[model samples]
Target: MTSYAFTFPGQGSQAVGMGKDLAAAYPEARAVFQEVDEALGQRLSAIMFEGPEDILRLTENAQPALMAVSLAIVRVLEARGLRVSGHAAYVAGHSLGEYSALAAAGAFTIADTARLLKTRGQAMQKAVPVGHGAMAALLGLDLAVASEVADAASQGEVCAVANDNAPGQVVVSGTVAAVERAVELAKAKGAKRALLLPVSAPFHCALMQPAADAMAQALAEIEMRAPLLPLVANVLAAPVSDPAEIRRLLVEQVTGVVRWTESVRWLTGPGGVTNLAELGTGKVLTGLAKRIDPQAIATAVSTPADIDAFVAQLGL
Candidate 1:
């Protein structure tokens, strides 16, 4: 039996026709999409399956679309008799992927997760005015050095680390001028590339305080339960199972750094996660997991064929 950690991708992973095939092939998968559409009270399914690209790419649309696809994949796996509660030991996600992990782990229903993400996306976008904030990736720099660069480049603006994706990859987000300054400082500090990311809003920074406040109120209204399995939280990069702590972390995550590199390391090292199954649109997280821990078996199951292969491997 494989002891795996199931993870879902954040933004930048969604694509047109992402979960359409699975919906076509499996009723279980179709039901997941239907549930999400009903939850959001709209035809987001149409936007996801046959997208205008621009509409689907909107932060509000993209968050729930990605979660729906991820939950669909999980439903397919469950239909195949591959129970996550039985085989998986831990669950973690990258950024917004944390919501997917929570949905998968039974902390919330797929409908609730979709609704929450929709609110989260809209809040994040509305928090900062366009052209006022931005995010940039600092390649070839570790977290400590990247933090220093961001701090030095603040220039009385709100520049801070947003994501520590991999050992050498860090993303900074804040006021546009501060992020640009951070880019220059990172380049001067021997960063291989300090490129601005094409993101709609400055996420995961103090500038997102409005979004955090929005989420705090929204989450307080939602029902939360302790997960059956541990979740490696984004802000802490550590396993947490308490419902209240998870809620607090979710609010913090809106403005805290995503410690992804540390989260992956925890899964493979002290967390005892041996296999990592990525349940989402793209294989980006799988690729990152490979680079993060080569010994960990990473699998991507977006399509029906991929799920079939996974079931066969599990002898289910």
Candidate 2:
């Protein structure tokens, strides 16, 4: 029997008007947005539906907002009798999407995940001052070469690999000068392209130590159960079942590189996962998964139409 993997997207996939169709069509889906809004004590759903673009793009808003949309889609799928627990062998998310995976796996309630992401977003946004840090994507460089470039560029400043997105795509983050130097070094080292990213904060680097510390404290107070399914953690790229281990990794992920390439390899190779279902707002993870493993069947579910197609395919 072929097994399934459920992958969730993180920050950048968020866009205005996400989940509105499901919310309108399914009462179960609409209830998810309502719960998140009440949990946050604000009209976050309104902002996601009718974003001023800037407000939704803010780190603080984007994290929880994306999670809410992802969960809403999950609810609609469940209401149609497609249970994630029965379908998925493993669940994983890119960066903050990990929280969404945990919620989907029943490790934490949607309410708790929303609250945690809100605090995490605010803490990460405040970690480094606005203009002090930066991130850059070094395209056409493998993880090893990208690491070398970041290390060479760091002059006692915090340049480090942030995201190992694919075979030839890696993102480095650190102090503005260090990141700038890394870009130049990558370009000089025969990288096909090295460009500065438009991200507001330098994420998944040593510069986020303060944010990591803050998350350590926040996660301590929350109750985390072992996920019903194993979660392939972002930092380690391995399936972890212990709740304590999950909490520790969540904190470490703040200042650690997202080993996405290694993660996908583990899932498709050793973990024996196939048929990846991207149960979130965007096709970003599906596209990346296909790039990582051309033979893998990756699906993206965002709206009512997507849900209908998926259920029909499964003969559910």
Candidate 3:
């Protein structure tokens, strides 16, 4: 009774020439880029294919660009006679990648997903002024210890755990000084590594409440359908299939901790998911899956060769 789940990557995974090879080989993949460009009313494909890294790394551009690359891989897979509904029992994503997962599950059109992610990235960036907020990664510390470090560092400021990524990897987000304090405290508390991330804004923290409010309004106007497979929500770390509930959680996720560690455990645990397929540009999620559960089968399917190998292995 082995099962599989499709996973999508978030912002930091994007690169300048992410889906170019895939699009060159598959018309379906090229169409995904075309649709995303049309939806955004701009030539995002050009930026993605040939970029000044700085521009592509912009929050607003990176979010939808990553989603488009993910969906392009999904489309290529479908064109290759491998269907998600037949292979995956669940879908999950990190941060903005949630929108990509929803779209892959047929909950939203690619066009709408592109627009929504653009709006989301902009809102998140505007939520806090530059240099006023920050994020940091704490390695060799679990959620509880990380929370303690964040709490001890807060000191009337807003330092909170943003992502529980793996066994001993956590990210904290908050005001710049508070986050920097957390980094110092994490090292003092025996964390192997604690470093501030170079990010445009503090995400998945109370500082993002304004972005959450903005998402509420944007999501309310979009038509959502129940996903083909249940989603492992970032906030809940559990299966959620209800469309209305999905919408609510999307808003909550803006300022909530991404319980990726718990979500991966649930998938490899009682969910009985044996295989985790990362359908995007980078192998970041694949690498994280191995860190989370070395026994779990993790695969990356970005290029045509990867897809071919996967299809052959699955006998699809």
TM-score of each: 0.98, 0.98, 0.99
Better of 1 and 3 by lDDT: 3
Candidate 1 Cα deviation (angstroms), residue 289 = 1.0
CA RMSD, predictions in order: 1.0, 0.9, 0.7
lDDT of 1 by residue, 37-136 (tens): 9999999999999998999999999999999999999888888787777878999999899999999999999988999999999999999998999999
- Cα displacement (angstroms), candidate 3, residue 292, comes to 1.0
Clashes of 1: 0
Q: How much lDDT does each candidate structure score?
A: 0.92, 0.92, 0.94
Name the runs in model 1 displaced over 4 angstroms. Answer: none
Model 2 is weakest, by summed lDDT over 10 consecutive residues, at 76-85
Error of 2 at 262 (Å): 0.9
Q: How close to the true structure is residue 134 of candidate 3, measured as C-alpha lDDT? A: 99
lDDT of 2 at 59: 93
Q: Which ten residues in a row have the lowest lDDT in candidate 3?
A: 76-85
Give one digit per residue, the lDDT tens place, for model 2 in 70-150: 888888888888788788889999999999999999999999999999999999999999999999999999889999999
| List of clashing residue pairs for candidate 2 | none
* Highest lDDT against the true fold, candidate: 3
